[model samples]
Structure formats: C-alpha cells, structure tokens
Target: MNGQPQWQPISMLPVFTDMIDGMLESSLEQLQNMQAVKDKPHVLDDSILGRVIALYSEQLQNHGAFQEQFNRWKKTGLCATDLAEVERLIQQLAKLKTANETILGIAKSISHATIDKIMAMDDAELAVAFLSGKLKRPI
Candidate 1:
C-alpha cells in the first residue's frame, strides 16, 4: 500500500465536541449577564454592550463552521459513535439557539428604550446627553 495507511484518518468528533461545549458555556454566561440587565438596558456599560455584539458575531461564525465540519464528517462515513456525538452537539446547539434569541430580545428592548429616551429629548437636551456620554453613537 506504498507508505499510505490502509485505514482512514482519525475522526475529529472529539475536537468538535469540545469546541461546542466551550461555545455553549460562553453562550450561557452571556445569557445570564444579559438577563441581569434586561430590565434596565441603560445600566449596561460600553464593554458589556461590545461583548454582546462580539458574542453574536462569534455565534454566527461558529454556526457556519459547524455546518462545514458536519458536512465533511458525513462524507467520511459516520459510525454509531459519530451519530451519538452529532446528536449531543445538536442538543447543545439548540440550547445555544435559545440563549441567542433571548440575548437578542434583550438587546432589542434596550434599543427601543434608548430610542424612546432620545425621542423625548429636545435638540439641546440631545446635545448635552451626547456630550455627557449619556448617549452613545451607533456602532
């Protein structure tokens, strides 16, 4: 067989599993943090807001990566072990999906509240609020 191995290469299922676990944990932490400030978005600091946006972006990227990895794994012949891992990953993904939705909802409510506050302000008030750091420019 020349120098090539006769068997197929090892599966990457474990690596994918670990990655998903970490993502799930991070997502859950984000969800908890968002819940704490859901009722009072104005209290959120710039760092927290930036982190939320970053988490959302990371989720999108991770989703695409997962899909690509799944497709490639399927092409290599899935066994029972692989199927089990895939199912677990799917369940974790579902939880992540729920968390992401809640996070977005909280973000939406915060945006609405901020907009209402801005709408009630006069031009002079708006300028003062902006200058005083009560209002932030859109990212």
Candidate 2:
C-alpha cells in the first residue's frame, strides 16, 4: 500500500470547512470562557483542561489559515498541492484526537467528585461559571 493519502474530491471541501469551522467556534467560545474568570486555576492543577483548551486554541488558529486555503480551493477546485495540505491538516487533527480524548477521560475521572458540586450548584451559578469558564474540573 502507498504511504501517502489519496486526493480528496472537490465536493468534500465544504464538508471539511464546515467541520473545521464548528471546531474553531467551539474552541474560541471555550477560550473566551476561560478568560472571563480571573481567579480560576486553569493551568496550575493536574487537570488537563488548560492543556486541552490550549490545544483547541492552537487548532483554531491553524483552522483559520486552513480556512483561507479552503476558500482558495473552493474558487479553483482541489489541486495536488491542496490535497496534500488537506491531508496534512487531517493528520494534525488526528494528533489532536488523542488530546481531546485525554480531556474527556480526565473529566470522566473527576465526574464523581464534581457530581456533588454540580448537584449543589444553582442553575444561575452553574451557568455563570460555565459561560465565563470559571468552572474548573473538580478534583
């Protein structure tokens, strides 16, 4: 089998763009939340939330560049070099896959501790913390 990836069709470009757009938006939203809270311990704890957020932010910036390339590809259709770049981006996202899973696993591990806290939290408080990103993963 060839080690390189096959070229993607022009039709798939929009789909890829949409997927990346969603991810970028989510990352940006999370970053905003993280920034709003001044006292939250985001990076110091063993919690991987900070790392995950940073990863997402990096991905978002990458996606912005990719978006420009995508728009160009849309106008011109996919070329060999464009396909290669897309494949590279896919690989980068694949690496990010592991980090995303780690974040989920960490959250799951701490969910039990958070359950009581979450349960005790009022809707308004929870919403504020969640929106502002003040909510740290409960250890």
What local distance difference test score does each model get?
A: 0.68, 0.52
Error of 1 at 45 (Å): 1.4
Question: Model 1 over residues 20-93: C-alpha lDDT tens digits?
Answer: 88878987898888887766666665556667776775675566456555655666767888877777787787
Question: Using alpha carbons, what is the TM-score of model 2?
Answer: 0.37
Give per-candidate clash totals.
0, 0
User: Which regions of candidate 2 are displaced past 4 Å?
Assistant: 1-9, 24-78, 115-139
Candidate 1: C-alpha lDDT: 0.68
Candidate 2 per-residue lDDT over residues 31-108, each given as its tens digit: 454443323333333345545545654553454455455445546656787677666556545544444444444444
